[model samples]
Target: MAGLDFLNGELEELKRQGKYRLPSVWESGSGAWMDIGGRRVLQMASNNYLGLTDHPRLKRAAVEATEKYGVGAGSVRTISGTLDIHEQLELELARFKDTEAALVFQSGFTTNQGVFGTLLQEGDVVISDELNHASIIDGIRLTKAARRIYKHKDMDSLEQALRESSGYRTRFVVTDGVFSMDGDIAPLPQIVELAERYDAVVCVDDAHASGVLGRFGKGSTDHFGLHGRVHIQIGTLSKAVGVVGGYAAGSQALKEYLIHKARPFLFSTSQTPAVAAACLEAIRVLQDSPELGERLHASASSFRTRLQADGFDTGVSETPIMPIVIGDSARTMRFSARLLELGVFAPGIVYPTVGEGKGRVRFIVTAMHSDEDLAFARDALLQAGREFGLV
Candidate 1:
C-alpha cells in the first residue's frame, strides 16, 4: 500500500507539469475519418499514415485467415505456435525491406526490447540519439549496457559519443528513422558514416517511416539508399501497415539469435493468425502501390505551407506529421479540446512527449483524406487556432 501511494504523487506532478493526458476512446474503425466514442471526427492524431486500417484487402485477409487458422496462436512462437501464416508474413516483410531475413514481434515497442535485450551484453555500449523513442531507452536499460546520448540528429555529437565508446567490447548506434514529435527524419546517411568510422553496429527504428517513406515504402534504409550498410532495421505493422505488430529485418543470424535468446519473443504468445495474414496483405498493397505515400506527403506539404502562411509555427516537419507549436501545454491542450469539439481529433503533445514550453497539436495527414476533408480541416484549424491565440 505504501509503494502504491507513490503513483498518486507522481500523477499529481504530471498534472502540475501539464503532462497528464487522457485520450478519447476510439471505438469505431480508424481511418481518415473515425468515430471517437460516438462522435465522428476528422482524424489527425493517429500513426496510420497510409489510411489502410480499414482497407478491403486487409479485411478480407483477416477474415480468410480467421476461417483457416482460427482466432489465436495457441501458444508462444518458440513453443508450438509458429503458424504457416506467421512464417509467410516474415518472408514477405523480408522481401518488402530487401533484407536478408525478418522476424516479427507482438508490437514495435516489444521489437525494440527484444533486439537490445537479446543482442547486447552488460559491457556493450549504446550510442543513441537524444530524441530516440522511449522504447529504445527502455531497451538499453534492459540490456544493462552503457549508454551515451547525443544531441538529436547531430552527427558531430554522435561521432563524439562513438569516439568515446571506442574501447567497448561492442557498440551500437541507435536512432529513430523519423523523430515522431518533430516529424524530421534522422540524418541516417551521416549516422551510417559515423557508425562505420567507429565500427559501431547501427540500428534504426523505422516505426514512423515504414510504409510512408522510400520506394514502395521500404522504410529508412531504402529511403536513404543505405540498404546493406545498417545492421538492424526495426519496423511496425500498426502505423503505416494498418495492422498490429512489429518486426526486425536483419541478417538470418540475427533472427536466429533473437529466436533463441529474446525473452519477450520466447515468453510471449505470438500474434494471432489473422493479424499475421492482415499484415502480410498490407505489405502486398504497399508493394503494389506507391501513389498512396506520394499523395500523403503532398497533402502534408500543402497543409504545412498553408499553416505557415497564416503565421502558425509549423516546426521542421518534412513528412505527413505536422505540429503546431504553442509553447504552453495548457493552451495546447485547450486548443486540442476546442478543435475536437469543432470536429477534428488532432491531439496535444505536451511536456515529456515533447519538452517543457514546446507543446503542440500534432497532425498526421493520410492519403485517404479528400480535398473536401482538407478544406474542412483548414477552416477548423484556423478558427480553433485563432480562438486559442496559437495562430
Candidate 2:
C-alpha cells in the first residue's frame, strides 16, 4: 500500500487532464434503448449491431444450453473443456465463412493474440495497417516477428511495406476489416492483390465487419468476394453475434496449428455452453433474417447523412460505427455528458483510444433501433452539438 501511493498522484493527474472516469451504470440489457442511472436513454454506444443480445431465439438457446450443459466449460479447450456444442459452433462458423475449418477463442482480442503469437515467429514479418485495432497492435507486439505499419487504407504504403518485408521467411499482412474509430473499411481487394504479389499471408481482423458486411454477414472478405483467396479470417462472436467469444476461420491446417500452439487457446478456458449456443443461434438468425443487416445499413446511412448535412464531421465512416469528431478531449467528454442529459447514452472516445486532437463521441447504429428511436437520438445529438457550437 505504501509503494502504491503514487497511484493517487496519477489519478489526480488524470482528473485534471479530464481523462479519469467511470463507466455508467446500465440498468437494462444492451438493446437499442437502455436505462442508465434511472434515466432511459437511446443506446447508441454499444457493439450490439444486430441487437441480438436480447433476441428471443438467442435467449432461448442460451437457456437450453445452460440446462443441458450446466454453466461453465471448466477448463481450457486442449484439456477437458472442449464440448460437442463448441465443435458444432466452429463447424457452423466455418460453414458461415466458407472456410475449410475454424477455431474459437475466449474473445476477439484473445483471437488476435492467439493467431499472431502462434503464426508469426522470429524470422517472420507482419505488415499491418496503421489504424488496426489495439488488439492487433498488441498481438503483433507479443510475437518475435518484425512489424511494419502502413498508412491506414493506403494500398501504396501497404505494397511498400510488403516489398520491404519480402526478405522475411513469412510475410504476414494483417488489417482490421472495419476500423473501429473512423469506421472506414480496409481496402481488402488491394491488400489481397499485394499480398498475392508478395506471397504474404493475408489475415483480416473482421471483428466489426463480421455481422455488418457481406451476404448474410459472412464478413468483409465475402463482401469483397475474396473468399478462399484470403488465408486467415479472424472474427468476434460478441459484436453482431450478441454473445461472448472470438474465432479464426481458415484452412484445417491453421486450425490444427493454433489449437496446438496458440497460447491463448491452449491456456484459456473454453467458452461457456450458454455463450456458444447463443452465438450459434445468432449466426442462424443472421442467415434466417438478412433483413436485420439491411435495415441496419439503411438506418446508418440515413443517420450518417443527416449528421454530415448538419455540419458534423463523421470521419471517413462507411459503416454503422460513426464517430462525430470533436477536436478537444474535454469538449468531447462534455458533449457526451450533454447527450446523456438530453436522453442519449453515447460515450466519448478520447486520447489514447484515438490520436491527439481526435477526440470523438462514437455512435454505433444497430438493427433494433426504430425510426423513432434514431430520430430521437439525432435530435438529442444536434441539440448537444448546437450547444457546444459544433453545428
Candidate 3:
C-alpha cells in the first residue's frame, strides 16, 4: 500500500496520452451486433469470424454437455479432471486438424506456453517472427533456448536466424499463421522450406487463421497444402470455433510429451466438458458445411475492398482482421469514440500493441455481418475519419 500511489500516476499519464484502454461493457452475445453501454451497435471488433457463438447447434451441444457433466472439470487435467468428453474432443480435434493427436489447454496463450516451455530447453534455439503474438514471445522467454527474431514476413531474415542457430540441439521457427493486428499471414511454406534446410521444427500458431483460412478452415498448413511437413500447429477454440479453449495438434508422441511436460496443461484445470463438447460440435459443423468459412473470407474481402476504395489505408491486410491506421494514438482513440458514437464498435489499437506512430483502429469482419452491415460499418468509419481528419 505504501508504494501503490505510483501506479495511479502511471495510469493518469496513460489517460493524458489517450492510451488508456477503457473497455466497453457488453451485455449481449457476440454476433453481427452487440449491446454495449446500453446501446445495440454493429460489432466489427470481435474474432467470431464464422459467427458460431450463437448458433443453435453449438448452444445445444454446450447445454447437453452441462446437463450430462457438471459445469467444471473440478481439477487439473493431470489429476482428476480428464473427463471422457475431453478425450473425445481431443480425438475429434486431431481428426479435424489431420494430425496424429491433439491436446487442449485452458487458452490460446497457455497453449503457446505449454508447447514452448516444454519442448525447448538449454542449448535449444527458437527463431521467431518479430511480429508474433505476445504469448509466443512470453513462451519463448520461459525457455532457456537461444532466441533469434526475424523481421516480419522476411524470409531472408528468417534464414539468417536459422543460419545463426545451427549449433543448437533443437531449433524452432515460430510464427502466427495470421498476424492479428496486421491481418497479414506468415509465409508458412517458405518457413517450412527454411526449417527443413536448417533441420528446424516449425510451429504455427493459427489462432486467427483457424476457421478463416483453407478449404474447410484447417488453417495455414492446409491452406498451403503443407500438412505433414509442419511440426506443431497451435489453435484456439474461442475465436472462429465460437467456444473457449486452446489446442496443439501434432504427432501422437508430441501430445504424449506435452501431457507430461507442458506445465500449463498439467497445472490448469481442464476445459469444462461443456466447452469441449461445443467445440467438438463446431468442428463437425465446419466439416459438414464449408460455406461458413467461405462466407467469412468473402465478407472480409468485400469490406477491405470497400474501405480501401473509400480512402482508408487498410495496411497490408489479407484476412478478416484489418486495421485503419491512424498514426497518432490520441487521434485514433478519438476516431474510435466517434465511430462508437455513430453506432460501430470498432476500437483503437495503440502502442505498444502496435509500433509507435502506427496506432490504428482494427476492424474484424465476420460471417455474421451482411452486405448491409458492411456498408453501414464502412460509412460510419468514413464519417468518423472525416470528423477526426484521419482521412
Candidate 4:
C-alpha cells in the first residue's frame, strides 16, 4: 500500500497556523445551556435562534410521527420515499413563506446545490454576493453559467455585475438574506430593484434569516415586504426551526421543476417522518405565537448593544450572529479557548471561513438564553477580550 504522508504535513501546517479545529463535543441538546466536555456551559455558538429544539410541542410531534411512520423513509424521494407527511410539511412551509409552493431538501447546503444546479445552465449568468455562503459558491460552481461576484452588500457592485451580465440567456442575482459570519443583512430592496431593471432573477438564501427576521419569521422577503417580487427563497429547519431539513420556496412551477431536475431532491432520501412532522409543527409554533421571534430579536439587540458599548468591533452586525473581529487567527483561537474556559461556548472563525486577517469568534444569541445567561456570556467575553486587547 502507498504511504499517504503528505496530508499529515498539511494538517500540521493548519495546526501551526491556528486554523485546525476539532469540533466540540456537545453531550446534550443544543439549548441555551449545553453539556460540553462534561461541563454545563452557556452556549452562544449555535444557530438555534428560536430555541425550538427542545420545545415540548416539537418533541411531541416528533414522537408521534416516529411512532406512526417508523424511523426512516427508506428510499430516495423520487422513488418510494415521499411520504404524505413530507407533502404536508411542504404545504405548511409554502403557507408560512407565502409562496405558491415549496420543496424540502435533505439539508440547507444541498438545498442550495439543488436550486442552483437545477436552475442555472450554460449561457446563463449568476450574479452572487462575494460574502454568500460556501454552499452558494459551490452551487454556482456546479453550473456552466457565467459567474459575476459583487462586493458584500454593495448595491453599486451588484448593479455593475448585472450590467456586465446583460444579454445572457437568464441572469440571477443571489445573496444571503442575513450574512452568517457578520450577521449583517443584505441590501435586498436595492438588489430587487436592480434585478428588475436588468430582468434578472432574485434568489435569497435565508438560512440564517428564517425564524430570526420578518413578521412571524416568514423570512427576509417578508421582512422587506417584497412578497411576490423575489423569485427564490431558501430556508433551513436545522437552525431556528429546531429540526433538520431545508426547503426552497417559489412558484408552483419552480417546485415541480426542481422535483424533476434538482439532483439532491431526486437522489437523496426524503426527510424522515419525525423530522418532517416536527418541522411542520415548528412552522405552526412560529406562526401562531409571534413572541418567539420577538424575544429572539430583543435578546440579540440587547446583547449586541452591550458588546458594542464595550468597544468591541462587532462589524456591521444587525442580527443575532455576532462576530468579534480580531485580526490574528492564533489570537482569535486563543480568545475562543479562553471564552470556553470561562464557560461560554463560542467557536473561532478563521481563514477559509472568512478571509485571512479577518479572524474572530462568532456568537449566536438565541431566544432561550436568559438575561442571566446573557450577562454570563458578556462578562466572559469582556474578560477574554481584555486579555486579548480587543475591547
lDDT of 3 by residue, 27-65 (tens): 998888889778999999999988888889999999999
Candidate 1 residue-wise lDDT, 53-143, digit = tens: 8889999999999999999999999888999999999999998898889999999999999999998898899998998999998988897
RMSD of each: 1.5, 0.8, 0.9, 0.9
Q: List ranges where model 4 is wrong by over 4 Å.
A: 1-3
TM-score of each: 0.97, 0.99, 0.98, 0.99
TM-score of 4: 0.99
| Candidate 4 lDDT trough over 10 residues, lowest sum | 1-10
Model 3 — which ten-residue stretch has the worst lDDT? 382-391
User: After superposing candidate 1, which stretches have Cα over 4 Å from the reference?
Assistant: 1-6, 9-13
Candidate 2 error regions (>4 Å): none
Model 2, 136-228: lDDT tens per residue?
Answer: 999999999998999988888888888787789999999999999999999899899999998999999999999999999999999999987
Better of 1 and 3 by lDDT: 3
Q: If the candidates were sorted by their lDDT against the true structure, best first, what order would they fall in?
A: 2, 4, 3, 1
In candidate 4, how many Å is residue 150 off? 0.6
Report how far residue 16 has shifted in candidate 1, in Å. Answer: 4.6
Global lDDT of model 4? 0.93
Error of 3 at 233 (Å): 0.2
| Model 4 agreement with the true structure over 1-391: per-residue lDDT tens digits | 2488888999999999988998788899888889977899999988888889999999999999999999999999989999999999999899999999999999999999999998999999999999999999999999999999999888888888888887899999999999999999998899999999999999999999999889898899999999999999999999999999899999999999999999999888888899999999999999888988888889989999999999999998999999999989998899899999999988999999999999989999888999999999999988988888877
